[model samples]
Target: MAEKGGIHVDSARELFPRVAEVPFDAEYKFMATFHNMTDEQGKPVVRCCVKGAPDVLIARAGYYWLPGRDPAAVTDENRKLALAENDRMAAAGERVMVVARRDFDPTTFDPKGNLLDLVQDLTLLAMVGIVDPPRAEAKDAIARCHSAGIQVRMITGDHAVTAAAIGHELGIEGQALTGAQFAAIPDEQLKPQLDQIGVVARVTPEDKIRLVTMLQQKDNIVAMTGDGVNDAPALKKADIGVAMGITGTEVSKGAAVMILTDDNFATIVKAVEYGRNIYNNLFNFVRFQMGQLVAYITCYLLAAFFFVLGGVPFAALVILFLNFLISVPVAMALGFDKPTSGLMDKKPRPLKQPLLSTSQWVRIAFLGILMAIATVYLEAIYEEAGVTTAATMGFVAFALLSISRGLSARSETETAFDRDIIHDRNQMFLYSMALLITILATELGFLQRLLGLTSLSGDQWRICIAAAIALLLVDEVIKVFLRSRLHDVKAPVT
Candidate 1:
């Protein structure tokens, strides 16, 4: 990291009597200063000035300081030995690199004349290998991903043998392919086999982009993780681009939609769980609101038709008051619903699937029409008694049906009284409060007048209450039928 005593050399033209400092890639920096003494001992040495493959000192400049004259540092013999050593260590899953620095003459080498410019004559110092074992929890995380029907792949610019060795150690099983092999494969030929190729090694940035594009064409939702300028294109191309905040280049981070502060792979699993829940919650809100809207329109039209009224029973302000005090609050509370069991056990939802299907819309229509019929039937009975109570009772039924909708919204399979609903205290409270407020508003004299409604007699109130209860009863019966239908639909055949 530092050179205090040695005269700096610029290339082989001017050599330092002894070179002191080198880059992080110079793994022998610690077993160093013996640098010169060790060089005399013939330690697999090669000369490096400022250029070559920037291995461990990736993306950095001026970090390397070498001082030698010979440009033939990488002779055929040296390359052979280096490759042999790299293979040996890599077979043991070690990341291996050869360190090289330059020898310099002490008097002529400039200590301060632009370190990068002057330190040109490079020398091969030593070959150092490091083993960065995966984290203890990484295997477990991968296992969880597999269980949840997710696939994990490793793509790197590392050597094929080294990458494969590491993949095996990490319990990753897949056919190995180099970037060149991938590039050579025709797109049509590659589609079916793409899922089998796990470890892609010696890949350039273009290879990564091609992989992402190919995966997308196969209708796979690809989430690409990267942390370099070269990674920007593929990251942008992915369905979800994740960047490592700590180590990612600005270009890559800008292209990515999600940035991982800790850069932990397991964090992605957690994110997926939350993302699915957020979407489910949004759907629940939509399902509830849309159903309520449909039911209100149905019930309002039926009552108006039965009573021969030209206009709606409720005023515009009444609708707003009811929505504010009832619907919105309850919907907001539904957002807090706990994630269902085995949230991560399911495969990823289809990207093409809509939030609601046609069948769900039909169910909504049925629920709405039922509420309308119940309300209209009650309105007719009250009007027949000459009590002038049908209109007020119709409004009550509307509020009541809206309140009961939460139960249906919570589950498609589970009934209102099922364990999933009964055990959820938040949901129970939300349901209770919505029902209580709606009932209270209809009964309260001041609120009823404010809503432009006449007060109902006690007996008439009982009738409205009975009719409202029927809507829930009808809903429960429908739920039971629906549950049975679902069971039959899902039943495995012999």
Candidate 2:
């Protein structure tokens, strides 16, 4: 056994025989060991080892045994054998160590030597490059964003040429800038360049942050997408940060508001549609509620004024009941309605736009006032015929208004007659509920008495149904005119 440091070797063949030649052994035992080394500051550093079978031992020490003469011309055959044996040992989960002496001439290996010269000896391992192909749906999604008044930009660490190529493929417009170009611009100057610089390449993490800040300075709501650790900071700074979960680092995902599990650009497009739909529904419901509130307040105030003047009209109280109980339920049914055709095709409403825009307020005001006027006029005629028709006329008017309001609330882009809106199962369900409520209110004695209302006579019922049909027809007519105007405006001009 020969001992060196922590290694102990036992072999039948003598490694350093004093004679002219030494006999080779069929079997050998070899080992190499090491312990941690400490620096001058007493910090422990990693240790290493080198030892194995004679041929194995020589190779492990990074030495090539020559057939004759020089000790360096071992050829490729021996090198192949050494690598194969190492792989076999590795497959068995055995750790194998390779040791090699530094072969550089000390005089030539200067500290300031060009690193590229040393790197030239490194052959191509498998090409370690990424091919981030645009998703098939990315182009369509980009077009959709453009139509929706949203700008899409590509910010990447890839080379300018590669980034521009991808941006072109994804349909992004404007100039492409490398990191150097972006860095050369002052922060104040970057603000005006955001719209014109659509593809930013080789940008650092700080560059992304600055870009987002510059966009924010212009009051643009930026939605950024990224999948790297460096992207985390920018993701957190954007209005909406979308992370590609499939390819994103944990840091990026943690900072994002939304994660795309499939990393498909189409997902963002779908999400935008859904978000807009939710906001639209919310706005519609609120507007409808506001109209109902205004009507209720007006009725109560009028009823109080009339009572104070000693008139005390029962019809006013009836109107109040109708506004709260019947009109409100019908308007709520509009919330459950299906999305209008071309909903996604329309641009997103400006975030700064008031909740009650002029057009929306005008529609609500006109419809509510028209409904009230028509109800009162029709009831007045029924009463003028003089068959003790106070309760009956009120009931008929209330019923007509309730049903017509639903049709009036149809999308500006579509009519109540539109197949998609009319055929939605949810809308159908709401209509069924409305019908049930109306029927039950008419039949139930307590409800009828509380509201000073009554079921209609056969002839009176026919008139009420006719009035409802007329109201619906008027609602449809308004929608058709508005929809036609909208279509004309949206149509491509020759």
Candidate 3:
């Protein structure tokens, strides 16, 4: 925006394209870029002028540009009109800049000195409105975050009206607070209301850092996003620092933990979804392995206590077949389990929460006992054939039952017969291979000799397979009970 002797030009770049083409000398060309400053005597206006050029100074400010100028040119009616226009543009989610110009003598101008005194009696130029609309997917992303129990906020150096307008459009709820108001309030008062503030306007770098610190003190997980050099401190102080790859300065990028290459808010939502999926996958893997260990230990100890004819429950090679051949492959396959439905609908887990929750522990205990009992029952039924034969029956029964447990581990609440597993072809194929390998190891003549196992008769095989199916059925029943109980239950984060 440009003006000369009361004549206004809307397109400044088009009017002086050649003058704008010169390579920028960053230090002196753009002086007093407004961000978090109150000049001497508490004035908010800032002046910027091109170095080594004509003595024309361009000033940008909010509503404060009405003072220290010619009252005849900027009459009361014009001042009211300008302020109204500024509010109109700001409330429409456009950044409003009040531009005014003043010419000085070039020979007497000092680039390093204060230019606030030189802006007196300025010619009121145009009140230009700039629109930097949010990305198309940003609103949807913010909605997703809210559904996931995540709070999003906007901290900008724009006018409070502009920030509030943008916050409302993005579905962020809360009142807007300016930097001056924030500084006036004590931290004790602000902490309780921090969650209720959706936008913070005209904040300095120090104010941003303080805001992050306040949120962290309340156990809130703060993810700060920025693209400026002044944002480095706050970015580093945040729990997750997101940098705009397209427009971010090098300092901001270096301070951030994650960089948005596309500079889209939707990407952050997708990242959260994938991150939760990975965390769930890890939890399931650990639970699967631990539950299998409990099953094996309980079975061994029960056998040793009930039947005394054995030096060992199973041979050394047989132990290897149970773990490496059957358990490890299925455990690894559990890592590929997709996120369960409504994964993001749950609240975030607490920072101090344990890896295994209490509910998870209870489920593991119940399922592990059921599996052990099934394996021991098979051994008891076949014991008269001798300890070796009983051991062989127990090994095969344990391996098959363990595979069923792996299937159930794919979901915390969903049963084995649920559509979750039925629709996951990759898991089904991998599990089928594990069962096939276990059966081949026992039935093939050379393999049976290598594994130190006795060949099972058709009747014995029937009992073992029935035992495996019984374990699966019982676990599925328990899951049905859990689903009913936990349907409306909220996940505990503390």
TM-score leader: 3
By TM-score rank, best first, the candidates go 3, 1, 2
Runs of candidate 1 exceeding 4 Å displacement: 1-46, 49-93, 98-129, 165-172, 308-315, 385-388, 418-429, 452-494
- Each candidate structure's TM-score, on Cα atoms with residue i matched to residue i, is 0.73, 0.67, 0.84
What's the lDDT for candidate 2?
0.61
**Deviation in angstroms for 296 in model 1?**
1.9
Estimate, for each residue in 1-100, the C-alpha lDDT of model 2 and write its tens digit: 1254444443312332211111222122233222334433565432222233323343333334344434454446866776566545433423343332
The digit string of per-residue lDDT tens for model 1 on 1-494 reads 12333534353224323344334221211121212222454543223333223232222222232345423435556555556766788778776654445555444545444445434434454455668888877777777777777888888766677788988877677998877898899999998998898899778888998999998998889999998777889999999999999999999999999999998888888888788777777777888788778777876787567553333645677678777888876787667787866667667767798878998888778877876676666666666554335656766766776776765566565566557767778877887888777767767788777775566677866776676667667767877888799679769998
The local distance difference test score of each candidate is 0.68, 0.61, 0.75
Which of 2 and 3 is the better model by lDDT? 3
- lDDT string, candidate 3, 28-108, tens digits: 222222122234456543333222111122222222343555324555665566667777888999887554444444345
Superposed on all Cα atoms, the candidates' RMSDs to the truth, in angstroms, are: 7.5, 14.0, 7.2
Predicted model with the maximum lDDT: 3
Candidates arranged by lDDT, highest first: 3, 1, 2
